[model samples]
Target: MSAEKWTPDHLQSAENRSLHLEQRRMQLLPVVDDLRRLAREMAAVVKEIDGIEGDIPGQAWMRARHVTKPLFKAADDIEQAIGDLGAFNTRYQRSYEELPQKRAEKRRRKALAKSGQPEAIESAPAGSGSPKKDEFEDVFDGLRQGA
Candidate 1:
């Protein structure tokens, strides 16, 4: 008669997982944004610093800045990781929504099983036995007996 499939411990654990995922998302969103912002700013600063003609040996630092490829790639990676997590969250939501329906279906099947209705007759396997004619033979039994 119970509609829910989850035990109290299972439900509690599911809630905990959901909360943890949300917290992870919350924490990561800002970090990803900050990384993106830093990447963008690095590009612009590199461009500006390019205007300076430097005989300076610390010019290696400038070389590090002039290329935005690695920075942008890192930002893109962060975004991709966030996107993957979001997908996981979506899947979790869908499974959570479907839990009740799945439980209801299982309960219906179980109830049907327990209701003690005769199971459907299945065809006998090959060589299991000769076909039984008694079901049809009964209808002609009286005619045969009278004759």
Candidate 2:
């Protein structure tokens, strides 16, 4: 019997599914970015209100109240958006993980037909170099020494 050959259709299906998930992930990224920006703006507004409280005596109280309401509302919206982004991220991660598995399965099927033996799994080897330190650690260490 002739050796069975793997077809393009299986690979194409996996590629299509991966592309679809990627598209969904891309769509959510902009919304997440916008929410993050809004959150930062709200934080800035809170700081501005705090600064104004010390400068302006009577009117600052009323203005702070008004500013706080909207800031809280914006914060709420940011929280919801962050939750949505987290869910989207989970789905994106799952799709990303599946894509590699599908590709590996296709390769295994081809190998089984050609070699008539179980396919061997390959993985990246561990690093040989020393571990790297985070950038913030150096700055914090300097601050601690100065203090």
Candidate whose lDDT is highest:
1
* TM-score, model 1 to reference: 0.44
Task: List model 1 lDDT by residue over 1-147, tens digit each.
Answer: 124443335433446546555666777778778877888887777766644464576675666565777777786887788678667656765676667877776566556657754331122224544677776888898999889
Per-model TM against the reference: 0.44, 0.30
Scanning candidate 2 in windows of ten residues, the lowest lDDT window is 1-10
Number of clashes recorded per candidate: 0, 0
Q: Where is model 2 more than 4 Å wrong at Cα? A: 1-12, 51-147
Candidate 1, residue 68: the lDDT equals 74
lDDT against the true structure, per candidate, is 0.64, 0.57
